[model samples]
Target: MDFRSLFTRKSKSSSIATQRLQLILTQDRFEVSEDSMKKLQIELTEVLAKYFEFTMNSVSMSIKREGNSYVLMADFPYSKTNKIR
Candidate 1:
């Protein structure tokens, strides 16, 4: 018996709603506005674009809480052939 099949699957709308709720909760907990995060992501992408070729969609930024400290994480993918430096 497969335990995975025992639970009903979530609909796409439900999955999207859950993701949105999680984002809102995370932003509230970190005291950061959605606009501010977007600005930060844009600025980071612009700065990194000077040295590498990557699409804006390839960039991701999020805040994480670790013990007593809050950490900002950013991820971007760049092709080796397009490196400027």
Candidate 2:
């Protein structure tokens, strides 16, 4: 084994295919356009990033139907490396 291999650390991020599938599912379930969804995500990310530390693609947004209304749910997982200053 190469000595450098032992010292190198790899980031175990989610697969691109899985992420793409998730985006498609979210858009289809919510009846949202891909462009609109991405625009909203980016705007929200900009606002929240000012206060909290989160990875760009880690944010998940979904719409849930509740009887006569729908609820928008957003989840932003904090980044382990970026801390509040």
Give the lDDT of residue 19 in candidate 1. 84
What are the models' TM-scores? Answer: 0.64, 0.57
All models, RMSD in angstroms = 4.8, 7.2
For residues 1-85, what per-residue lDDT tens digits would candidate 1 score against the true structure? Answer: 7676568575468879988886786687768888887887888888888888867757776667899987877888766776785
> Which residues of candidate 2, in runs, are more than 4 Å off?
1-31, 79-85
In terms of TM-score, the best-performing candidate is: 1
Best by lDDT: 2
Candidate 1 residue pairs in backbone clash = none
- Badly placed stretches (over 4 Å) of model 1 are 1-18
User: CA shift at 4, candidate 1, in angstroms?
Assistant: 10
Clashing residue pairs found in predicted model 2: none
